[model samples]
Target: MNTEEFNNKFDEGQSMVDDLDLSKALRSEQQLTRISIDFPV
Candidate 1:
């Protein structure tokens, strides 16, 4: 469907999961960076 149609469905709180095309969806890079911290009591 077009953008307007998609927006209407989303605005109406309808389910749009089935209308999505994720065949080439990209996976976000989630590399974690470690941090060092010291706390004094």
Candidate 2:
């Protein structure tokens, strides 16, 4: 393929990776809580 085509594909792939990184960062910023209770029979 030509240089231009290769560059375009590379840019697209890079953008997808960047978006994934951003989503992961955003997910890490959220708060989560869990609780468990047990009962005896």
Candidate 3:
């Protein structure tokens, strides 16, 4: 594949990985918020 094609594929893959990481981070944040709310003292 050409450099342009490789760069496009690499960017796409990077975006997908970023999206996955963002979702996981949001989910964990939500869980932490819920736990904190539940255990408020």
Clashes of each: 0, 0, 0
At residue 18, candidate 2 shows an lDDT of 37
Q: Write the per-residue lDDT of candidate 3 for residues 5-38, one digit (tens) a residue.
A: 6679787775445324455455344553334346
Cα RMSD of predicted structure 2: 7.9
Worst 10 residues of 1 by lDDT: 24-33
- Each model's C-alpha lDDT? 0.91, 0.64, 0.56
Q: Point out the worst 10-residue segment of candidate 3 by lDDT.
A: 27-36
Assess candidate 1 and give its TM-score to the true structure.
0.55
Error of 3 at 25 (Å): 33
Per-residue CA lDDT of candidate 1, range 1-41, in tens?
Answer: 99999999999999998998889676789668899999998
Q: Assess every candidate by TM-score.
A: 0.55, 0.32, 0.32
lDDT of 2: 0.64
Model 1 ranges off by over 4 Å: 30-41
Comparing 1 with 3 on lDDT, the higher-scoring candidate is 1
Q: In model 1, which residue pairs have backbone atoms overlapping below 3 Å?
A: none
Model 3: residues with Cα > 4 Å off, grouped in runs: 14-41
lDDT of each residue in 1-41, candidate 2, tens digit only: 56786679787775445324455465565788888999998
